[model samples]
Target: MDNSNMWIKHKNNRSIKEQVDILVKLTETHKKCIGLPKSKREVEFLKILYPASIRNLEIGDKFIGKTDYSAVGFGCVTSTSGVGYFFHKHKIDELKNNTKDKELLEKINLVEKYWCDKDTQENFRKELKKSNPEFFKKFAKNDNYSCVVCGFSRLSGMQLNYNKLLDLGVNGLKKSILSRNKDGKNDFYRASLEALDLFLDIANHFEIETRKLAQSLIGDKLEREEVLKVSNCLKEIKKGEKPKSFREAIQLTWLYGVVAGVVNYGRMDDYLGEYLLDDLNNDKLTEKEALDLVKSFWKMIAWRKTVMNGRVTIGGKGRRNEKAADKFAMIAMEATRINKDLEPQLTLRIYENQNKKLLEKGLEVISEGCTFPMIYNDEVNIPSVASAMNVSLKEAEDYVPFGCGEIILCGKSVGTPNVLINTLKALEVTLRNGYDRVNDVSLGYNTGKIEDFDTFDKLLEAYKTQLKIHIEELAKAQRLSYDVMKENCSFIYVSLLIDDCIEKGKELLSGGARHLGGTLEVYGNINSANSLTAIKKIVFEDEKINLKQLVHILDRNFNGFEEIRNELLNAPKYGNDEAEGDLMASKLHEYVCMCIKESAKDIGLDSFLAVVINNHSNTIWGRTTLASADGRKKGQFMANGNNPYNGTDINGPTAMLNSLTKLKTDIHAGSVQNMKFSRSMFKNHINIINQLLEVYFENGGSQLMITVVDPKELEKAYNNPTNYRNLIVRVGGFSARFVELDRQVQKEVMERTLYE
Candidate 1:
């Protein structure tokens, strides 16, 4: 798969030969680990990979951790973690194509041969086939139709505990990891210790290189000064001491996250705030200096290639030091205003009785056409998470949104959205009674034929049956994924930083974390709601056609049935403030959420819930999702998150807000609501925009990702993308520069109504 699409181009790929060197070192080190313990081997590979990594000390860049395209992230074993080893089949081919040296080509071939049958997927297959053949086939089939007909991937969506890391320091964590060791017999302890030691070696190697580079630069005083400062920061952090300044804190967090490939940095202000405040109160650094450090951190986040996963949350209730956090949050918002990049997906959690000036600063940032900080409402989310996760309200304060707005408890749970359920496709397959017309294969559970459904209730039951089966199997997959990861290797870095892992002397997936919960991503939510509503109105309630006739219309892709399609389209949709249609969505949404939560207990998980947090999967999956009662063309993008399908919510923004808030919030992990505003209204009516957000939050809205732009500008930008590289827009859960998106996704964005 071409990963260039999902991930942002965050780093400058080192020259091809240099990349080859890194891969060669990694493979050579990997070969040495053949007879060693799994934990030791993985850590040893990193120790070699680190010193060999290309060290860059660019004049303007402050942060030091940048690796070649060989792979990013901490784990070297699996693509789900970091796609390390840089020796995949395609990569080897590319390397062979580029390099003329027979030696290098042979070395690359050796690397490929080493991992050919020993990689994560291959190992997983051997294990699963031996232990669970039936499930392995099902998992493979799900993968074959991934991101389209609902599937799971090793792509983990989670956040590391920045506060814990900043507070504990390397020494503190080291002591904890070895605390329970008796004669070094514990395998977890030995591996964790080695991993930490090797991790610090990576830092130590860079520190020395940066120092050497700084010493050599005599004429460029500013460059040398900055380079020396970075070298010193690395030295201080590698000494096993907690960060004493804001720069140290941010630098440590960013570098560690880069190595670990752990995106979704949780509550930046909460962790790094006190350090900034200390700097301010003690006159160690001016506000401008601190702000510059933050801006540099933001830039580094964009430069690192996490794409869609670099989430940095700030602001909200239950903060340990609200004043300090607020101050840091304000600075962070200002940084966003200054550096309008797509990464570091800066998010602000808004609440009542909070800092007004901070919010005003956020508005200033947004008014500048920055697609962040995407505002999440704590008033709705806090209570919702407490109930959904069965935790206290105070514990709920730990709730932070991970990849594409899926809510997970920071450092406490591994809520990787492993399973995906396309609710719209659930309806589509139900209509086909188990057949997938687009793929020309019979997939999913057969809930009986259209002729068997005499009433709308029966039709609804069929949809429910199909959903129940898919979600249940996927839940098993979700749990089994962790089990598999645990079998192959211990996620040393992930376990070391997250909660209860060190304390429990176990890896996170191996029962080290406080909460071993999982999440299922639901896509095409509003489109599904609209389709079901249309079906009920046109087929059962209105009686304009029977179930068989409606299925026939859908089977024909609305051909020769344009009139019926129009009628179906005219039926009540979810985004309108209409109670009946909104209620239908609410009912179906509640059913799915509740069913998932129940499945968690049945499967022996601490907690599990559904999330309507969609990335581009709505658009990606919509291509294969057959046409339905929603009036969407067979391959048109599905309704984005819980937002209205494009141009279907004619009752205006207020009504749309009303319809959006109708879905029960407490039952699910999170649901994304995307809203667009015309540039005229957003700029001229800033107060009204503020009120709209406040009222929605106060009612029941959890999160709103707003994109304010002129539709004409979007069109112009789309037509001539090279000239408008700076144009950014919110695309579902993740925001991207307008010109960066594909033509179909661009069209979907253009098709959205820019409400006046």
Candidate 2:
């Protein structure tokens, strides 16, 4: 991956330097607008953005915005240099001081009022509430206070229809776009053409700009040579043809993503690998140059400054063009080693026959504690996703992991986690006859008191009933909200890129995707399971405490009952691989999955599955949950994503792994497993760690999100934030600076047993 001579020649070149300068200028300019009042600034901002989206696809005389081989595009409508997406009103206060330009701000407010608003998917919530007040009221019955009940936010991240881009090429897509603009065209056709035309216009803008910049660089020997290369790449795309060079292919890919606001690059090695191999074979580019371009692109991806960086997945089954994908995957690994930036989160998919060197490289990256390239097991996920999505093995091969580890078919499905349900809260309601002690309300259905249940199975049955009702009500709410979005706030650009949309002549939101599903994020799994086990053992089986006494202790938040709380905590816990606790976990997981599947069918959805990847919501949900029979005090953060409650996984890492594999992952979309290893353990017992992972995946573990850090170092960082400014740790689905997390999150990280 090294070519020092090539680097020397291009290192001091003017074209590349100028491109960086332009990007930096644009980024700086965009940063200043962040603090401006949203109402005033939104209109002024959109006025500029509307034309940029519709027009500004051409190149400038300078090479700043022109990069034919780069992985990311410049000049997004909302943010210049692709620093971030459109700003939301709530983010205006990150500023330490107010902007002094009063008159300008006022003018911005006035201009914004006249501009037509682009309705986001979030608008559907308001519309759904307006149309069906009863549905919203049902979920919002607890005065919109409980994370268990009031979890109704529907947000989705995307993986572009790269198959369209890679297989059809720019020209082929243009033919489809143009065919739609006939007289008397339906709204779907008209909107699809409008969106596709805007895309082409954007392509032409970059092409023209690149050509002009190349022409201006004449007589400047080295820079002119480089600029013309860029110009040729752009001209190829402008002609609506497939990319003739690796550079042109990458440019087309980035620009399309920019226009569509789709960040995750679905199986890049599969899509772009063929062009790269062709270029290498034809002596058009060297490995070093390709590696350099990838690194540059990696930098662009990191610039977005969003929570989930654009995921560029490499090496998965069902990849159409597997030509030089392995070579590119290796190069991508090397590029991450060089760039060391947090995102373009390079995720590598591994199976039994995957290149061993690639796995070794991924381990090396993890060893360096960069927290990426995140590994996914095709052996487990392929089958798991196939079953959950009810798709064929070949179709399931297109499954891509989105933000926080939810699986959605890349070009074929829309499976967003639209609502969150707290299983632990259901347990609480079951115990107290439908009363929510924490929120001081009656939120769930009254199923009689725990004392009335003669057997533990009866108590479990009551809890199951509550879960089914909650899931049914929530699923209906989400389906209705999505229908409103489909009817009114159509995602035109997104529709044009996703599959079956153009084929059906309908929007992706409007049943155009091959599979339409909603994911319910079920948080506090281990917490609830452990609580049920404790109650079953101590109260019903052992008779260490009567049912009435246990209820009294729980209601008092476990105060003045330290001895009983200890007894409850000492009861067999999950993550210990004990049969008693593991059996309970299995039963609870089975019940949740059963309810989710039934609710999906009841609500007329193609698929609905549970995702236990509760990114930071474990803590949020804990805020509204009362003390449990597991001896957990009220308001304490719940367990983190199928992980055991804090300090409760008394057994070692292997036992914990075994316990996690107890759940039925095939019936679910995805779940996150967070495990921490001490630096010494990871470094010393690397082979053991590798074998453990292989066994876990082979045994049907869905996803493993590991955070390797020394407990001492983490504690130090938490105590002295300024000393370890760059220390990062994986929290659920994403990684962040260790010191920047909330105090409880930081504590949670510290509490995770550092395997040694």
Best by lDDT: 1
Candidate 1, residue 460: lDDT:
85
Q: Which residue pairs of candidate 1 clash?
A: 10-303, 73-261, 74-260
TM-score of each: 0.95, 0.84
The parts of candidate 1 lying over 4 Å away from their true place are 1-5, 8-18, 71-87, 121-148, 153-155
Model 1: per-residue Cα lDDT over 1-58, one tens digit each: 1123354333435766677777777777777776886667767766766655535666
Per-residue CA lDDT of candidate 2, range 1-756, in tens?
000111111121133333333323333443455464322232233223432433222221212222221111222221122211222232122111233456534433332332213223235456656865754654654333373565433336567787687677755765675676456355666555445555555556666765676677677767766666666666676666777777877877876675555656788888788888998999988999888777866766665544543677888787766658888888898988777766776778888877788888887877777777778889888888888888898889988887777788887888777677888888888888887766576777888786788788888888888888788877877687576455433455666678887777676767677788888878887889999899889988999887778888898988899999998999888898889988988888888987787688887788989887866667666777889988888878888878877788888887888988898878888777888887887888899999998888787776677677875999899889999888878877666778878888788778877787
Go through the candidates in order and give each one's C-alpha lDDT: 0.77, 0.68
Stretches of candidate 2 off by over 4 Å are 1-122, 128-145, 152-155, 177-184, 207-235
Instruction: Count steric clashes of candidate 2.
Output: 9
* Model 1 accuracy (lDDT, Cα): 0.77
